[model samples]
Target chain A: MSGSPGAGRSRIVTWAVVGLCLGLAGALAWAMLDLPAPSTRLPGQVAAQLERSGVEHPVTAVLLNFRGYDTLLEIAVLLLALLGMLAAGVAPRASAPLGASSMLAALARALAPLMVLVAGYLLWAGAFRPGGAFQAGAVLAAAGVLLRLAGFLPAWTRPGAALRMALAAGFALFLAIAALGLTEGALLRYPEPSAGALILAIESGLTFSLGLILAGLFLAGPELPRREDGGGTP
Target chain B: MSLGLFYALLGGGLFALGLAGLILRPHLLAKIIGFNVMGSGAFLVLVGLGSRDGVADPVPQAMVLTGIVVAVAATALALALARRLLELSGDMVLPGERLRPGEDDDADA
Candidate 1:
């Protein structure tokens, strides 16, 4: 291993280190010295217009009305992620080996419910406040991860029709709303006075589907066999 | 572009770097690390942009809050995949070959 030893190896190592440092310096310099202007006038401009028109929950309005199409796509992206996980032959982690360290078990007991509560709060806050369905779903999934890690939850739960319903709710509900647009010429539009409520409703559905889909993806495959095996019993 | 512009560009660059690292690194776990870097970078950019008038953009910050969750979900999924790969392969880590199940025990002994 020491045949060519000091010279060749040291020279290469020295250059590699130098190159990395130089790259870092250059990147940092650029980021620090030059920054861009905000092209973020769209939201503000829209909000102002909504405000002028006395629109309630302008942020919600923006999300549900002007940007409903994007929201629809975002939800679709999440579905695709779950579907991709399936196609890739990945599955949710087997339920935690259960009864691991007492510390983990105790932590799960205390944190799981608390995390769920926080997720609910975050979701509720999304309307006329801050935060939303995505954050809530993440929190819910995190809680699930904790329980799974602590072995409190089985690697796979028995599949039920409820799971299927929850999984499809977001997409299905959004479709119904968009259908309204078709019938009323709104084209996925939310009318005033109901925009906030609609956004909240859509978000709730999104939270449920998103949480399940993510947890499913993170759960890893064998735990929930492919459709051919009939899900849950594992 | 101002700092807001700087924020987006820098964040985008970091994300791109992270994405590149995730793809280029052969190790399964390294991809996760790259993702974390990219996620953090993007988050920083969003937050940076939010601080427009020396106060954060409530909207971007909130959206980023949502984004953190999405990122976490993706990470969880990737991790589960890595763990399964290890279990199926009987290798604690085929990624970077960095950590093996009993390597630590051997070192301690």
Candidate 2:
């Protein structure tokens, strides 16, 4: 490749950008230098309020109960991104073998099931501990990506009606719940006795949708072919 | 002086580094990675700010968690676009520098 006329100008622009970035960074650091450690106002009250949300994990309660609106919008945003990818008209990569070693395939086979277990565990533990729907969904999606990379395209890579439904399930369920909550005088306000069940249900839907959405994104190169197996496991 | 402050400063640095990468790099993929770095920096800052009270704030933590999911979604979209651009143009660099109209040759490899 030969150097172009713009190369010199681009170099100068790059240096100027670098200087600007450095200055911005320094200014930000200096501005925050005097802030007190551990903000004076903690989320103690918010944490205490979690008991009323019918979940043991404060963060989970906050995400699914107190601030369900944000979660709802977030799921929507994820779906929107997936739609953008699909609209790009890129075909999924060919089904040709990924040139992976048999050992890698064997490893994927062993880990795939284990990943499911861990994801399930995380989803369950989210009600009481540090795990939640997003973490679980990500793990499940990682498993799918691993399988895809290892030349094990699940029979459902195509953006068929069923796959699309799964992708939309989380956002749809969340929106439904929010609408229902509106009838209860507050949007996303779950009844106390059923808050736990509702949150769990919503989380389950989210987990599935998020996993499928991620897998679809990973299969970005080609529009995945319709599975001949009619949704059966490969 | 607190650990949180240190992390916040680190977040600022990361943001700046990401900004520089985004601007200085001509490759679309590199810019995407830089965008992600910037996002993570913002997340770190949010997390640090939430920890201002000796106890971690669950609200901001939840926000950050949502942010992470959103960031990944955005990254995936960016990647898909980058891949598409590569497929169409036979190159992955941003258009302004490498793809001036009427320049048919790959001037700079």
Candidate 3:
């Protein structure tokens, strides 16, 4: 590949870029040395504030309550990426029937429910443990991926109305809650008494939406026009 | 150096490696992998730097978790784009290669 006449010039440019990147990274590391330790002030305050956030898990409280707007925006970004993909017409194609592969079919059958159970547990444990919506959603997405890899076409592959609703459900619910807060308190300000429940509701919705979005993303199919007869891509 | 600082250095090295790969590799798939490596390195930097004082900071951990999820999404998008490019142009690298008369026909294979 480097036999081309201009390869040396390209090699020189690549090395120059690499050198520049290294210098920048070194500067970053050095600059970070002067900063106060992370557990000093703000993180300590965050730890203290977790109690008031109505969650035992500090990370969960931070992600879904204290700095929920960030989570909201992150979800929007994920959704936006999915939307962009769909708009770009990268749709899933119908794979060959899975009946031929009894082994894969049996694997999907065995693992799918187990993955779902784990996802559920992860979602429920987020209030007090390390798991949360994203983790749970990821597991759920993995299940979808496993099924797809096994030649099963999930309903979301069609991007039908119901699938679209499922995809947007999390963002819609989050915005609705935030809008409600605008009338009572600041945006996304959950009532203190119900903060835990509210967070759980939002997370549950988000998990479902995120799971669908992720699965849809993984199954980037060939574009198929919507069928009036409710038949997905042939 | 302290353990945290050592990890930070490791993160920096990984970032450099990933950056070099991203810049030097001609293949789109390699560039995508490089981007992922870079993202992971940055996450490592965040986690490592934030854990200096014994107590792990949950804030940065949460942020890193979010970053990980977003990175997956970004990688998927990049892969989709690369696949589309390959479908259209029949070459995995960036476009604008002037093909010989018979090369385009060969590319279809």
Across all candidates, the chain A TM-score values are 0.70, 0.84, 0.85
lDDT by residue for model 2 (A1-234), tens: 227767666657768898899999999898788664543444767766878897899899889998888999999999999899888866455345343456767788899999999999999999999999999999999999888766677433347887788889989998887787877898898878888998998999999888878777786555344434222233
Residues A201-228, model 3: lDDT tens digits: 8999989988888887887666333323
Q: Number of the top candidate by lDDT?
A: 2
Which runs in model 1 stand beyond 4 Å of their true positions? Answer: A1-36, A49-63, A87-96, A100-115, A157-161, A184-186, A221-234, B1-26, B62-66, B80-109
| Candidate achieving higher lDDT, 2 or 3 | 2
Candidate 1 whole-model C-alpha lDDT, 0 to 1: 0.64
DockQ of each: 0.22, 0.62, 0.48
Which residues of candidate 3, in runs, are more than 4 Å off?
A: A1-5, A38-40, A91-100, A154-157, A223-234, B96-109
Q: Which ten residues in a row have the lowest lDDT in candidate 1 chain A?
A: A225-234
Relative to the true structure, candidate 3 reaches a TM of 0.86
lDDT of 3 by residue, B1-109 (tens): 5677667777877887898878766678878999888888899888888776666878888899899888888888888788777767776788653333343354346
lDDT of each: 0.64, 0.81, 0.79
